[model samples]
Target: MKIGKIPPDVLERLVFNRRGAPRREVLVGPAIGEDAAIIDLGGYYLAIHTDPISGSIKLLGYLAVYVPTNDIAVRGIPPMWLSIALLFPPETDETLLDEVTKQIDLAAREVNVAIVGGHTEVTSAVGRPVAIATAIGVGRRYISTSGAKPGDVVFMTKSAGQETASILATDFENEALKKGINKEVLDRAKELAKAVSVLREALALADLATSMHDPTEGGIANGLAEIAYASGVSIEVDPSKVIVYREVEELCSAFGIDPLETLSSGVLLATLPPDSVQEAEERLKKLGIPYSQIGRVTPVATSL
Candidate 1:
């Protein structure tokens, strides 16, 4: 209903209830924690995720590619191809288009993903440029965001407010500076955007992860809640274990935004078996990825 993703309850009641007939090939359809739609394709499964870049304009193309790509990666598969769409306001100029396209191309190349096809139009109906992408991948074995068990441990990779801090700093540098956030800190915040993709951490812990989720629109809290909802369990998260940046805190405080509830794209939430935690931690450590065991899944509460 707001600027970010639709709340889970509303989506379940209105959208999820209206999804068409069920099919045998549809392994994973629309759900709360499930990131991508998985379709059985004989020997392997096809994972697809789609998202739009609507909140920020600084890195339009980069965000468009990475947002959905992060979803696909959490499925324990490398994104192979993407279908992108670009919608620009009628007043948009050729130079803006060039920069967006260039960014898209470079970001796709960096991830070794191909831009298959999409649509582009300059429409007056939109007020700004919006880029959307659908990422597709195939894998033999994959983890769903709904697979967490009751006793599984929950971990969050990287920090909170990663995308939020970066977007605010980059899009509102002057405003942030005026808010008493140091220039150097703002510059560092801008660099956090590059860490938005959790492909490496996702892949490293894929085998050990029973469930994995990308904290995008609703930050770490909502992401964990989605996992708990999807798995039919409750998560006991320790807020003290969450990594929060000072810059993010200050900027969010200045704007009256709750850092924990803000958008955080780079962070990954994972649920793993108790026995597999060691291996998962080892792999992440070897890869130089930071993670924290912030919570544990509990049995779902029921009415007496």
Candidate 2:
């Protein structure tokens, strides 16, 4: 198993295929690109998503809250509540616990989400602290990652690999400096962490987007691939149009990781009707959110 997301084939055979009986209320279940599980509650829909923060130790608490909530946001709903499970090793100190809790508290408040309930434990089952968060929200209308259709235009908010750069800068600062990455560049990259939340942008574009996805573990390329696979569409992306921040590129270059394939939680990928592109662009600009028109969705190729 890789360090990041499970391989698609493995997931289908071991996870997706084994899902229990279906229900009418489950509007959206597990799928390649779907961000959250949506359940119909009479007139409204409930969106729920869970994510674990295990990649970067320094940002575990912050990432745990934002990552899962980002999933709900991409579904066009504000995450109203969160349940976080904190797992720490037996030797962990009280100060570490306080720090992580404070981080979670601040992050949840920033997104206006309430931490209703959760569990905390110290055991030998884990070597490092891990924070898992599940976010829930309600909305009348929601978007799915599989809603993209042919002729729709693909758009991306923020830049690629922003989270990855921040992680490397914060968690692997010494390594980055040894690779000749300057302190100033690394500092700039660290600041990119604040941009990880796409809640505002996702909500702003919710009405306009046919589909939306929070590109996390796989960066923009993998995110696009998931959208194409889930929607049964083909996406033609212009590499030149994909925005990669200069600091992100520098850190990624030093680390020898593809910016397009690294974990990118800050970026939001969306598809919209060609006619709605103008409105979407205008909305993003008005909100002062940077974005790019990266490609178009097309029909999947078929043999003659």
Identify the leading candidate in terms of TM-score: 2
Each candidate's clash count: 0, 0
Tens digits of per-residue lDDT for model 1, 135-190: 99999978898898989999998878889888899888899888888888888888
- Candidate 2 — what's its lDDT? 0.93
**Model 2, 1-304: lDDT tens per residue?**
6677889999998999887997999989998999999999999999999888888878888898889999999999989999999999999999988888888888889999999998999989999888888999999999999999999999998889999999999999999999999999999999988889999999999999999999998899999999999999999999999999999999999889999999999899999998999999999999998999999999999999
Model 2 stretches with alpha carbons more than 4 Å out: none
lDDT of each: 0.89, 0.93
lDDT accuracy of residue 201 in candidate 1? 93
* Clash count in backbone of candidate 1: 0
